[model samples]
Target: MQWNVQELENWEELRTYVDTALLPLYLYRPEKPVKEHVQRMSYLVQVAASIEQRLKGRVLMFPLCYQIGDEPLAQRLPAGFAHYVLLQFSGDRLDAHEGEGSRLRLTVGDEDLESALRFEVTIDVLSQEIIRHWQHGGRQ
Candidate 1:
C-alpha cells in the first residue's frame, strides 16, 4: 500500500496488514548541479518503491522528503504504524537519529556509489531487515 487516494479509501479494510511506513529521504545541495540532485532523489524513490514491492501489504510508502545542506532534520514522521523505515542516501544528518525506537534508517550510497548493482544489494538488505523486524515483533 502507498500514501495515496486509492489506498486511503480502502485503508479501513487494508490498514491492518500495513504495519510499516516507509519514508524516502533525500539530501540536496544548492551548490551542486541540478542533475546530480535529481539523480540522487530518483535513486531514493526507487529504493523506497522496491522495498514496498518486496514487502507488499506490510508497508505503506510516503512521498519523497528532502533536506538541504546543513539544515536541521525536522521532517514529521508518519503515524499509526508499528514500524517506520527511513530510506535515504547515507548522510551524516540522518545518522544522528538512526535506530531510535522502531525506526529503521536504512541507507545506501554511503560514499561514491555508482552502479545499479548497489541499489539491488541495498534493496535485499533492507527487505531482510524489515523481515527481521517483523520476526522480532517490531522490537529493536
Candidate 2:
C-alpha cells in the first residue's frame, strides 16, 4: 500500500489501468438479482490486482466502497429498485490530479446499459455485496 512519487506522476497511466479494468463489468450488464453483481465487481478487482502486480512505485488499492443512498427515490421509497453503483478507490487514488484520474464520482454501469431507471435499481441491490466484501472480505 505504498505510492511513490514516480508512479504517482504517471497518474494518467494509472487511471487508464483503472478504467480499463472496470469498464468490462458494466459493458454487458449482468443477470437478474444482485447475486451476479459481484461478477461485475470482480471484473474491477481483477483489474486492480493486475495493475498492482505490474506497476511499481507508489499506488495502493485501498478497499472496496459503496453507498446505500446515492439516489433519493431509492432511499425514500424503500421499494425494490436498482441501487447506486459505488466507486471505491484504494483510498481515493482516483481523485488524483493526474490527466483523467479515477472518475470523480465512481459508478459501475454497463456501456450498452438500458436507458431505463429499473436497470439502475437492479445495480443497486447487488452493490451491497460489493461493499460487504470490501469491509468483511468475502464473496456475495
Candidate 3:
C-alpha cells in the first residue's frame, strides 16, 4: 500500500494487517543541479513503489523524505508500525538511525542502477530482507 487517498481510505480496516512502514530517504542538495536530484529521486521512488506492490497488504510506503540539514531523518516517522524500512540510495548523505521498532536499511547502489534487470534484482533483495525481518519477529 502507498500513501495515497485510495489506499488510505480503508485505513481502519487495513491497519491490523499492515505492520511495516517503508520510508524512502534521499539527500537534498540545494546547490546541486535540478536534473540530478530529480533523476535520483525518481529512481528511488520507482523502486519503492515496486516494493510496496509486492508487499501490498503488509507494508505502507510513505513519501520520499529528503534530508536538508544534519537532523535525524527517521525521527520524522510516527511511532506506530512494528517495523520501519529505510529505503535509500547507497551513497545518500543521511544515515538515519531508528530509535524505535525494528529498523532495516535497504540501499540501491550504483551497480544496481544499470538497467531494468538490475533494478528488479535490487527489489528482490530488498523484499527478502523485509521478509527476513518478519521471520525474526521484527528484530534487527
Candidate 4:
C-alpha cells in the first residue's frame, strides 16, 4: 500500500499486511539546473514505484524526502511498522556507502542510469535486499 488518503482510510484492514515502510530519500542540490533536477526526480519516482510494486502487501511506500546539503532526515514516518528501509538517491556519489539500524540505505549513482537493463537490475536488487532485511528481523 502507499501513503495516501485512500490507504489511510482503509488502515483498519490494511494495517495487518504492512510490516515495513519504504522511504525514498532524494538528495537534491539547489545549485543544479532545473532540467537535471527533473531527471533525478523522475528516476527517483520510477525506482520507488518499482520497489512498491514488487512488495505491495508487505511494504507501505511513503512520499519522497527532498533534502539539501546536510538537512536532517525526515522523522514523520508512520507508526506501527516492524521495519523501515531508506533508499537514497543522489546525482553525485555519497561519502558513506551504507549505515546501520532498523533502516537500510541503498545509494544509486549515474552509472545505474546508463541503460534500462542497469536500472531494472538495480531496482530488483534493492527490492530483494529490503525483503531479505525485513525477513531477518531488520538487523543491520
lDDT of 3 at 124: 95
TM-score, each model? 0.85, 0.31, 0.88, 0.81
Residues 48-122, candidate 4, lDDT per residue (tens digit)?
878888988888888877767665544555567777776676443323222333666677665546489988888
Clashes of 3: 0
- lDDT of model 3 at residue 66? 87
lDDT (Cα) of model 1: 0.78
Q: Considering summed lDDT, which 10 consecutive residues are worst modelled in model 3? A: 69-78
Name the candidate, 1 or 3, with the larger TM-score value.
3
2 or 3, which is superior by TM-score? 3
lDDT leaderboard ranking = 3, 1, 4, 2
Scored by CA lDDT, what does every candidate get? 0.78, 0.35, 0.83, 0.73
Superposed by TM-score, candidate 1 places the C-alpha of residue 69 at a distance from the truth, in angstroms, of: 2.3
Residue 79 shift from truth in candidate 3, angstroms: 1.9
Error of 3 at 96 (Å): 4.6
lDDT of 1 by residue, 5-109 (tens): 977898889888888888887777788899888777877788888889999888999898778787877776666777888787765455324333487777777
Instruction: For candidate 3, write residues 19-114 as lDDT tens digits.
Output: 898989887768878887788889999999999999989999999888875565655555778888888878665655534778888888855454
Q: Rank by TM-score, highest first.
A: 3, 1, 4, 2
Runs off by more than 4 Å, candidate 3 = 69-74, 93-99, 111-114
Off by over 4 Å in 1: 95-101, 110-114
Candidate 3 clash pair list: none
Cα displacement (Å) at residue 100, model 4: 14
